[model samples]
Target: MKVKTLEKLAKDMIDYIINLSGFEHIEDIQLNVVDNLESGDMAECNYNDSHGYIQLNIASNMINDIEQAKYVISHELGHILTREFHTYYVNFVGLDDDDMTSICSNVYEQTAEILAKRLGRLILKLYEQKDK
Candidate 1:
C-alpha cells in the first residue's frame, strides 16, 4: 500500500478507538512509519503521560495487507485502552532490564493481541462502510 493510504487507515483507526474510549485525559496519538524495526516486528506504541501523546510505529511490512495493518494499529491502541503500559510510560521502566517486568509485558502483549484482532476487524468494517 502507498504511505498515504496506510496513514489514512491508521488515522481512521486511532480516531475510531479514541472516540469509543472513555479516557478523557488521553492525548492525541500520531502514527509514523519507520524503516528500521528488527525483522518481523510490525509495529510498536509509545505513550507518555507528561509528554502528552502516543506515538505509533507502522513497519514497512505493515502496509502489505489492510487487515494486517488494522491488526497492528489496533494492537497498539489496545495497550493504551487497557492501560496495560501505563506504568511503563509513567516510570520509564525498561521491559528488558528485569525478568518479572519482561514476563508481565509478554502477558499484556497476548491480551492486547486478542483484543486487537477483534477490535481491528470491527474498525476496518466501520471504515470501509464510511468510504462507501
Candidate 2:
C-alpha cells in the first residue's frame, strides 16, 4: 500500500504512545511499513523527518515474522517518538543506516519503545473498532 494510507494507523499509534506514555504534543508524523528487507527479524526506519517509516519483510523468520513483529513497529515508532531508542551503527564507523536498529536509542528511546509495545497490545483491544 502507499505510505499515504498509513495516516490512520500512524495516528492511532501516536495516540497509543501518548495515552500509554502519558506524554503530550507528540506530532502525528508520516510512516510506512512495506514488505521489504531480508535476514534477521523485522526492521524499523525513519527518513526526511516527514516520512517516518517501518519496513517489515513478510517472509522473515518466525522469530520476527510472528511474535516479535511488534518490536519492529515499536522500534520504528521509537525513532519517531524519541531520539534515543536506536544506536547509531555505522557500516564502517561513519554514516549510519536508516535501518539503524540501535541508531538513536537513548533513555527516551527505551521508554518510547516500551510504550510502543504497550500501544501495540492496545491495538488489539481496538483492532475491531478501527474497522468499524
Candidate 3:
C-alpha cells in the first residue's frame, strides 16, 4: 500500500483499539511512516508523559501487508499499555533503574511481544464479529 494509506491505517487502528479497550489518558496519537528507523527497528512507540500523547513510528519498507502493519501497530500499542505492569513487576522484584540493564529490557520486550500477538488476534476477531 501507499505510505499515506499505511499512515491512515495506523491511525484508524489506534482509534479502534482505544475505543474498544477504553484506554484513556492519551491526549493525542501521532503516526509517522518513515523509510527507515535509525535503530533499524520496524516500529517504535514513544510516549510523552508530559503531553500525554504517543508518537508511533513505522518503517515503511519493513511493512509488507495490512496484517503485518496491524501487528506492528498493535505491538507498539502493547508497549504503551503494558508499561505500567512491566514497571510494577520490575519493582516488585526489587530491581531498580540501575539494575534494568539489557536483560531487563529484553524481558519487557518479550512480554510486550507476547501481549501484542494476543491482542492482535483478539482485535481481528472482534472486528470481524462487528462486521458480521
The local distance difference test score of each candidate is: 0.65, 0.44, 0.71
Off by over 4 Å in 1: 36-40, 49-52, 88-132
Off by over 4 Å in 2: 1-12, 19-28, 38-41, 49-66, 84-132
Model 1 lDDT-worst window of ten: 89-98
Best by lDDT: 3
Deviation in angstroms for 118 in model 1?
Answer: 5.3
Q: TM-scores of all models?
A: 0.64, 0.36, 0.73
Q: Model 2 scores what on Cα lDDT?
A: 0.44
Per-residue error at 111 for model 1, in Å? 4.4
lDDT of candidate 2 over 89-117, digit per residue (tens): 22233333353466443443456567666
lDDT of 3 at 114: 85
Q: Which should have the higher lDDT, number 2 or number 3?
A: 3
Best by TM-score: 3
Those runs of model 3 whose alpha carbons end farther than 4 Å from true positions after fitting are: 49-52, 86-103, 128-130
Sorted by lDDT (best first), the order is 3, 1, 2
Estimate the TM-score for candidate 3: 0.73
